[model samples]
Target: MTYLVTGGSKMGKSTWAEDLALELAKDGPVHYIATFKPVDAEDALVIARHKKARAGRNFAVTEKHQGLEAVVIPPGAVVMLEDLPNLLANEVFDDGDVSSILPGLKFLKALAEHFIIVTNEVGSDGTVYDALTGNYVEALSFLNRQAACLSDVVVEVVCGFPQMIKGDGP
Candidate 1:
């Protein structure tokens, strides 16, 4: 089963995903697929925070900062992908506009492993933006939509609380 957890920045999405992964680890091994790049001090701190939070757990960590398409994941292992917005940022857009978002949609679908993905929901504020910023917002929105469509369960975390947007088993 695939689960998608989405919320804006500082919205506790990763915390929730980590909690779920820990719970799943009680039964078996949990694989964490980290995609964040530690480009600066702040990012490095964020990575450290995650590491500390998940320290000494029954899990295997695989950090994939780029080229996630070829990664092989184990079956029945709960996987959590932290905030995919950064991955979408690397795409080259058309017309020099870069507004399109078909590649991300395809990546999420091809991951035939049991896992949960965490992403930011950036379009909820409904704020108007310039061309470049607007394209990014649109891309995040599109990515979330595709995740929702492909996910077996959809969860929205608010104020550190998890609310199920979709559930398991028909």
Candidate 2:
């Protein structure tokens, strides 16, 4: 079952995904695909924190930014994707345009195997009024929509609880 978990920034999406992946790991191997780039000290620290949180897990982590589609997804493996939009921002295009993410969306829809996808919900955010920000937000929203369509389960996390928005209840 392909699961898509989405929420606004700082809504504990990553933490939730990690927790769920760890739970799933009890049954089989888990793959943690990290798409975020540490562009600054703060980001680097955040990455470090996540790494520390999963310090002893049996997770095979692949740091493939936009080439997430290239990785071979093992069946029944719980794959956790950190953030689709950030992956598009870092690896899909040098200019960070929305069009670059279209391919990623198509790839996600075509992947019929089991996995867990995570992303930010940018529609409710009011900061994307600028031309660049608005375009990025629009693109991410479209990408999220495509993911939601293919996902067997869609969870919108808030605070720490997950609210199922589609497919089988989470």
Candidate 3:
């Protein structure tokens, strides 16, 4: 099962994705691919919160901000990708272009028995961002669309509820 989950910030997307991953994982190994790298105190808090959430969940977490092709996850592991926005940012600002993610995306699709990808919904705030942010939004939008196309199920979580936008429920 491949699920592409998206929602606004703090809208329970991550929690819902985690639960779904657990269900799909069953007795299999659960691997978490974290895209965010902590660069400040606030980032530390976010990391801590994620740690608390995954406590005792038996998740083998890997942080890959770039070079996703080099990931070492076990084949057929249930994979949970925390978010795509940060991954795309790292790729855009540091490593490579947005399309650079395609190979790694294909690799994951081939390796994982179950894949749950989480991303944020953007460009709806109606505030004009600078050129850099505008470019980022456009790139991420493209990335999310690609993910949705690859996914067996695409869901948008709103107010702690998942509204399925594609495919049947798992």
Models 1 onward score TM values of 0.81, 0.84, 0.94
| Per-residue lDDT of model 1, residues 1-94, tens digit only | 7788887678798878887877756667677777666769998998898788788876678876555654566544566776578666644332
TM-score of 1: 0.81
Choose 1 or 2, whichever is better by lDDT: 2
lDDT (0-100) at residue 28 of candidate 3? 65
Ranking by lDDT: 3, 2, 1
lDDT of 3 by residue, 3-44 (tens): 899999999999999889888888665788999988899999
Winning model by TM-score = 3
Error of 2 at 50 (Å): 1.3
Q: Model 3, 139: alpha-carbon shift in Å?
A: 0.3
Between candidates 2 and 3, which one is better according to TM-score?
3
Give the candidate number with the greatest lDDT: 3
- Angstrom error of the Cα, residue 38, model 3: value is 0.9
Candidate 2, residues 33-145, lDDT tens digits: the string is 88888879999998899788878877788877666557776645677777787786874355544454556545644653457888988877566488776866787788888
* Selected candidate, larger TM-score, 1 vs 2: 2
